[model samples]
Target: MINRRIMMTSLAAGLIAPAFRSAFAQEWKAKYPELIFAIIPEENASGTVERYTPFCAYLSREIGTKVTLRVVQDYAALIEGQKSEQIHVGWYGPASYARAYLTGAKITPFVIEVSSGGIKGYYSVFYVKKDSPYQSVADLKGKNLGLVDPNSTSGNNVPRFVLDKMGIDPDKYFNKVVYTGSHENAVLAVQQGTVDVAANWWNSDDDSNLTRMAKKGMVNKDDFRIIYKSDIIVNSPIAYLDSLPEDLKAKIKQAFLEAATKDKDAYAKLSDGKDDPFQPVDHSAYEPVVNLVKFIDGLRKKNG
Candidate 1:
C-alpha cells in the first residue's frame, strides 16, 4: 500500500512538471513582453535584416517571448545600443564585443558560430582588383585603403593590429584611408576603384564576403585578389545583457544551441548555409580580442 501511494505521487508529479515549466516561461514573457536582438551589418541593411529575421522568429518561438531584430547602422551603434541596454541581445564580431565589454556594458557572451569545417575562427583579408598594379602591401604605398568600420574586428581592428606589427601606420602609409561602412562596401570600393585595397573578412576561398557577393552576382570573384590576410580571429559571438533574469538568459542560450536542428532554415539563412550549429562560448574566449582592442585604442590615443 505504501509502494502504491509513492508510485501515484510520482505519476502526479510527472503530470505537473510540464505545467510548471509552461507557467515559468510565461512569467518571464510577461516581464519582458518583447526582446530586441541587434546586429551589425556585414552586408547591406536589407540583406542583414532578411538573413536574421527568421532566426529572431525562431528565438521567439523557443523562448516563448517576442524577439525582434534590429540592424544597427554600424558597429559602434551596435556597441552603444548594448551599452545603454536598449538592446537586450547582440550579434557581435570579436572586437566589437570586446569593445562593448571594455566600455562598461554589462553583457555575457553565450554562443559563437562554428564553421562547416568545425573550426571556430576566420581571417581578415585585403582585397585588390585582379588587374590592379598593387601586388603586395609594399606595392600599395600611397594608394587609397578601405576599412569596414572603426569597430569591426576583421574589417578594422585585426587589420590595424597587423599593419602596426609590420610598422605600417595606415594614415602615413596610404594616400587616403576611408571607412567603407560594411564589408560588402569595402569590397565594392576595391572593385569600383574608390579604394585600391579593402580590408574584409574571409573564411576560405569558398566562404567569404567576396564569395557571397559573387554568388549574388554582385561581383565576379575572379575579378579580385586577396593581397594580404591576417592570422585567425575567434569567430563572432551572440551575446545577451547580463542584467536579464537568470532563467531568461538560460532560455536564450538554449534557444541558440538548439536552433540549428530545431530551426535549420533560420540557421542556414543567418549562416549563409556555410556554418555548423552554434556552440557555447563565454567571456574567456574573447579576452585576447579585448586586449587587442585596448592595444588599438592605445595606438589611437598615442597618434592623437
Candidate 2:
C-alpha cells in the first residue's frame, strides 16, 4: 500500500506542475495587451479620434496584441506620458521627436511619405493671400503672422529658425503672432484674412494641402500664394519605450516594416495615403533636428 501511494503522489505532482508553468507563461505573454499608444491632437477632437482609431486596430492586429490610442492635449503631455511610461509608442514630429529622444524616449522607425520625388522630407511654406501685398519673407516684417504650434516642426520651429537666420526676430518682426494649434487652422486663418501670413507643412508641388482644403470647400486653389519654403524637414517618427524587451522590440519592428509593404490598405489608412508604413530608423538620423532645437534654444535665451 505504501509503494502504491508513493507512485500516485509522484504522478499527481507531474500533472499539476506543468499546468502551473503553462499558466505563468500565458500571463507573461498577455502583458503586451496593456500597452497604450499616444498621439498628438492636431485637429478637432472628434476628427482626430476618427482618423487614428483605425490605425490602433491595425497595429493591434499586426502586433498580435491589444493596443489603445489616446490623444493628449499637447506635445508636452505626450512627452510626459513617455517619461511616466504610460505611453508605449508615439508618432512624433521631428522637433517633438528630438525633445522626447533627448529626454530618453527611443526612436525606432520613421514614416516615409510618398510624394512627387518618392520617399522624401517636407518643407515649411509660409503663405499669404494671392492678392496680399506680402511678396517675400521680408515683407512680413512687423506684420501679423499665424503659426500653428510652438512645438510644431514645420509650423513654428522651421519658420522661426528661418527668420532668425535672416536676422529677423519673430517677436519683434511680427506685429502679432498667433498659435492656431494646427496646420489647417493656420491655413484657414490666412485664407480668411484673420492673419496676414501663415506657416504650414507642404510638399513641393504636392496636392495634399490643396486637396484637403478643396474637399472641405474651405479655400480655393487660386486664393493663396507661397512666399517662402524652408529646407526639408524629416517626417515624423515612431518611438518606443526604451526599456521594452529586446525580443519584443524586434518583433514590433518586423511587424511595422512588413505591414508597410504587405498591407497596402492598412498603410494608406494610417498615413492618409500620403506615405508608406514605416522604415527602420535610429537616433543618428535625427541629428539635424537636435541641432535645430539647440539653435532655437540659444536664440530664445539671447532674446530673453
Best by TM-score: 1
Worst 10 residues of 2 by lDDT: 108-117
Q: Each model's RMSD to truth, in Å?
A: 2.5, 6.0
List, residue by residue over 68-132, the lDDT tens digit for candidate 1. 99988987898889889899999999999999899898999999999988999999999999998
Per-prediction TM-score to the true structure, in the order listed: 0.93, 0.85
Query: What's the CA error at residue 135 for candidate 1, in Å?
Result: 1.1
Candidate 1's displacement at residue 177, Å, is: 0.6
How many steric clashes does model 1 contain?
A: 0
lDDT of candidate 2 over 125-192, digit per residue (tens): 99899998889987877888999876788888899899988989988889999998887788889887
Residue 73 Cα positional deviation in candidate 1, in Å, after optimal superposition: 0.7
Query: Cα lDDT for residue 32, model 1?
Result: 97
